[model samples]
Target: MTEAAFSIADIPIYGRILLAPMDGISDAPFRCITRRLGSAYTVSEFINTHDFSKLRHYQIARLAFQETERPFGFQLLDNDAGRMAEVGARLYELFKPDFFDINMGCCAPRVTSRGAGACMMRNLDLIRDSFRRLGQAVPVPLTGKMRLGWDETDLNYRAVAEAVVAEGARLVALHGRTNKMKYGGKARWEPIRELKQALPVPVIGNGDVNNLADARRLFEETGCDGIMIGRAAMANPWIFAGLDRDEVPIAEVFALARYQVRAMHAFYPGEKGLVAFRKFIKAYLAPCGLPYEKIVQLMKVTELEGLLEMLADIEAELGGQGQSRFGWEGLANPFEKEQKA
Candidate 1:
């Protein structure tokens, strides 16, 4: 690994690579599979504070994980200071996570419209207040994830970083872009370098880190303690382990996908599980050398038996492979393309 291992509040993180939490994607099944593949730590999906009173089984399922998924945290999102604290206390009392993280970096319109997520950076005082309240209520270490700010006119990432740490945030993950940038513009790492220089706590740099080379460049460029990956991980879960995606064996990829699918079945049963697992079908197939049209057709197989039959056919077709040249990066998400088109 290019970046050496580090820790957050004395909890030794065995590596410098972590899986950034995504709402629908980074659930227990995925997190557990990635942990075994090599990710150092994983954060839970952003749990909305308001829904705590009447959370469904599936909503709470995000928090469920095995002992192997240790050194994990529960990420809470909310605009109200008191509610954030209340949720923090409740999470500790119920889940007893290793730590707590406040979400200030989500840039979705619905989240920002509510004065949460990236919008939190627009108000430094509220950020500090919320962190303070959460710190007081929870005995574990407090951490935060954020973007540059709301936009260029209100770039207060440094100020927010200073405030959160003062209020007891032991670590911070900064996704180097603003709300307006979303996932479009290039992630500016210079500001992340500046923030790392200013903060006393460990800083994990996030944004646009798609592969091992990207991770190395970010660590070298920003000097942050760690790196967090989001979208790219969905394409290649073994990314953090420095596994060359281009050299991955087709059989190995198929086996891993089967394992993850079985895990999904165990966690989310019947059609619900099959429906949820559909999104990942293309991601897994991206590393297989099958034709795009064939892959697209295979991805449409919703029934578990049909999917397994297709995998068996693919395995037989590619019998001579040491490592298939097909890789995770640059593969198209056919579902996303159909939506946009």
Candidate 2:
């Protein structure tokens, strides 16, 4: 086996690159694809304890995962410690995730308006109480993902981090931007460095890591235990495999795109699968240089067969079948290479 780069509690995470839990984007299909590609572990899309406690189907569906996606986690977002602990125990009974992650970094208006997400950073006592309750409620280790603070004026990540860890958090992932920044400017890495220096457990640094080179730089700069890739993975899941978008051969890209669509189709029901898949089609086709009109035509395709046909035509046009020219056979598992090395 490849030596683990880090561990969340006792569960070994064999790779440093992880797929960030993105709502709508990191569904089971996509998470599994990234996992197969080489992501260290998978995290579910944010599960609002409010909805999940009510037995909502959508939130329940978000908790679904393949056994192969082990070391998986369910990320909970809410303001109430009691409710989060209750839901955490219930989910543990049902899904048995490797760990539970508290969502303290989301800056979305809908999330923040509820005094959840990054707003949690404004109150250190709440952070302490939540982790204390969560640690008592679930048998598994607890983790957290958060920003620098609520805003520039209140950069209290250190206090919050110390509070959570004191209560029971075993690992922390820091997105190096204030909630007010809302992904507006550059993600500051200095705070990540500080957290790594101060925290006793593993620190995973997030934000602004767009490629393998950037991943290396974040590790060098922060000495973080792991790297979390979010938006960049939407376009290039191969990033987890240590290959950039431009470096991937056209044939492999087409194969993975088709593989993802088929996976999505199987996971979601009926036309909803095709509908949900529309968001990814554009990202997969971005590097193809297809005309705007053709791209629109592909996007407009609602039927699975029609979408597959359109993709085939585009693949033939792009010479995707001519793999010999690129000297590529198939997508090899990068983790296997890592294990051998």
Judging by TM-score against the true structure, name the best candidate. 2
The C-alpha TM-scores of every prediction are 0.89, 0.93
Instruction: Give one digit per residue, the lDDT tens place, for model 2 in 50-114.
Output: 87777656443477787778888899999998999999999999889989999999999998998
Q: Please report the TM-score between candidate 1 and the true structure.
A: 0.89
How do the residues 187-288 of candidate 1 rate in per-residue lDDT, one tens digit apiece?
989988998999999999999998888999999999998889999988887786677577556766777766666566657645665677767867866766
Give the clash count for each candidate.
0, 0
Off by over 4 Å in 1: 1-4, 54-58, 287-289, 320-341
Relative to the unseen true structure, what is the C-alpha lDDT of residue 36 in candidate 1, on a scale of 0 to 100? Answer: 71
